[model samples]
Target: MRKKTNSAIRRWMYAMAYTAVSAVVLAGCGNGGNEPAAGDGKLTVTATTGMIADAAAEVGGEHAEVTGLMGSGVDPHLYKASQGDIKKLDNADIIFYNGLHLEGKMAEMFEKMEDKKPTVAVARDLPESALRTDPSGAHDPHIWFDVENWISATEVIRDTFIEKDPANEGDYRAQADAYIAELKKLDDYAAEQIASIPEASRVLVTAHDAFGYFGDAYGIKVMGLQGISTASEYGSKDVSALRDFLVQNQIKAVFVESSVPKKSIEAVIEGASKMGHEVAIGGELFSDALGKAGTSEGTYIGMVKHNVDTIVSALK
Candidate 1:
């Protein structure tokens, strides 16, 4: 586990204690509860990442008000929850997060919140066979890179919504079906686009190992300077190694992630240039987060499409 700063540890402790007390107070209230607390009559959903938030909003439709804790370019692996985030989780009818330690710093807090509300790790229930294991045999948490995996996550959200708000079961199911259909289309599009690149050039090198599932599903070889989680640091040796691999493989372009610093990839590019093999920054890919709101890449589908398009344009 990543070590938390003292201030972060203190904040987490305070949030946990505060939520425990709030849960008790809520349970003790005489009012027959378990219903939406929002005056707008929508289930208040707090999700850890933008992708999970998008899934909740799509599945919950008009019956849910979703808030994402981490926004574009925010790295969840290193993200620590704030007091305001604790309030959001405490007030939410349901809390959704990508499991498998993606939110490594906030995992303990989420576990504690489960006693108070329906705190769910949307990717927690995915089959073990579908996940990619790191060197330490830990499951990679960036399942959103694979459209099929995300489709499963969307269904998990739908089922949870139906269970918590049975009155909206039909709406949740119908909306999820529609959204899943769109994801199916996305999966097909990714396969087709990625297949267009020459097999020899079908290698994806990124700032981190967030695309194992993407490469597995779409037939591309993936390499990353950093480990599965961004919490794992890459050293000068790592950069030099990746630089050598890019040169030997004759890879023209390597991608950067929106949530990670560009310096690591820039170093690789420079090293490759020094070796007389130029490597271009393909484009920024949305790995742990999506694009800014209101932009095409802001939505989950848009994000996946943007990644596929960028990869194809650069390498094809």
Candidate 2:
């Protein structure tokens, strides 16, 4: 199942409202429960997305097994559990998901099934002051975009795992310590790289509002053509307004998200051109999904680093 991390084999889905990279074909049935590993009695930990699953597995260490119902590049904000995913949730002993309305499609489902399993919203435990607020009560859910914010959530996740599986408390703590240290390294590295870019060019423009944490932490301005989630449609007025921003600021680059469609951004660029401004497409940013499975960008740390490097290089 392990492979070199890079671009995935998933077909690039370009729908009217969103685009995404979904390639993971989960082998075992969500509830089909074949058998647990020889020693790792399947703890049946459920996560809302692959990124959360990756973190849980790293933090959970050998004490537990985790499952992510949503595959890579699938937007959590727009995710809805499939029939099989519902089965997985029904069978799970514990569930972990990014709160703050990140799981928009599954929010109600999670709420309705809350009593069935011990659910932990990783982002919910963070201090209200630390969160990225939006017009809606829910804050930005992509805490993982910023290493320090993610570290805070990691501590919460570790505690929750320990509470769920007290037998492996020590193991959980050890892994959490190691993972947290690595996260700190990532934070430092990101800061250093970003410093190379001139402060004026540090702005980041993407198709969706996915990098509020990144903006808050890195001293960069994050502007999105669409609102917080892709669920809301962008109108001509929004596109024209963004075009004016690009021309007024003379922004050099605008980014297209891996999961969000490029049409709206194209519209912005075109409008800016008519206004006599220049804008180009930056490299694809992994806003919602990591790279492949094994590569540097495939891991959470790698994902953030890739973003940092890409942004700094482009803006600088």
Candidate 3:
């Protein structure tokens, strides 16, 4: 299966290469209509994920035209950029992405583009002391799970924009300040909401280990069927082990992530049920991506609030 998947990806890459070249040539011919022309007074910023795009849009305000490549329920770890995305990246005045290998398949491409454009990894410059390491000793890429950490990422975006477009530094700073205050409120709300779950039941189980930072911030115990990245697969033994843990601890609920398949969680549910436990799917959580655009869950603050509300309602 892995081999077949890889082969398919290779074919896709080959196909995209042809499309990418044509896109670049076409873009050059028309000055890249996707981006604002020079003297249009707006910076063209492209972000890798919806969360990053939200931050850019809020901070950049009227000074930037922001575009995100991956949208709701999109998994960055396995995502491969399409030719159109390459064109957008090529024309962007600034590009922001969550680093620390979050966009695993696209990391190499970003590295290559760094010298060609103002590409910044919002999470990469964070103090190592503040980062959590996975079992493989790599920093966990889901830093947005912690509202405070996400605020730091926004600051990084603000700084990057200031450096790239100095004329709009003041605007960026003002918007960032406002956004930071709102994020503080969001952080407080998440803490208050999660606090409602009884201490004995203050445990979160999800499709993958994307909530380590969240659990750390809110004092909840989190378990995941798979590893930090959805790229990791769980076998029958892994499911059985989790089932035993749930059965012994009387954990009543587990969650499905927006970007990950529910099969593993379903398997665990079945395993626990067969063992005479009645475990339920607490709710769906936006782990790796936000909800659709224009919806409340589409925004970062709204996404966090939705997640906490879902968790509290189910586990309380």
Task: Kindly state the number of residue pairs that clash in model 1.
Answer: 0
Enumerate residue pairs that collide in model 1.
none
Once fitted onto the true fold, the runs of candidate 1 whose alpha carbons sit more than 4 angstroms away are 1-34
TM-scores for candidates 1 onward, in order: 0.91, 0.84, 0.90
Deviation in angstroms for 79 in model 2? 1.4
Position 19, candidate 2: lDDT: 19
**Tens digits of lDDT, candidate 1, 36-114:** 5558889888999999999899999999999999999999999987767867776788889999999996888778766
Question: What's the TM for model 3?
Answer: 0.90
lDDT string, candidate 3, 1-316, tens digits = 9999999999999988866674463444332223344887788888999999999999999989999999999999899877788778777788899999999967777776676666789996679888999878988899999998999999999988887777767989999999999999999999998888899999999888999999999999999888888888789988988999999999998999899988889999999999899999889999899999989999999999999999999999
lDDT score for candidate 1 against the true structure: 0.89
Ranked candidates, highest lDDT first: 1, 3, 2
Displacement of the residue 7 alpha carbon in candidate 1, Å: 12
Per-residue alpha-carbon lDDT of candidate 2 for residues 13-95, written as tens digits (9 for 90 to 100):
23311211111212222322223324446467888866788889999877667888776567777777665776666667677
Pairs that collide in candidate 2 are 5-295, 19-259
Which parts of model 3 have CA positions greater than 4 angstroms off? 1-39
For residue 163, what is the lDDT in candidate 3?
A: 77
Candidate 1 vs candidate 2, TM-score winner? 1
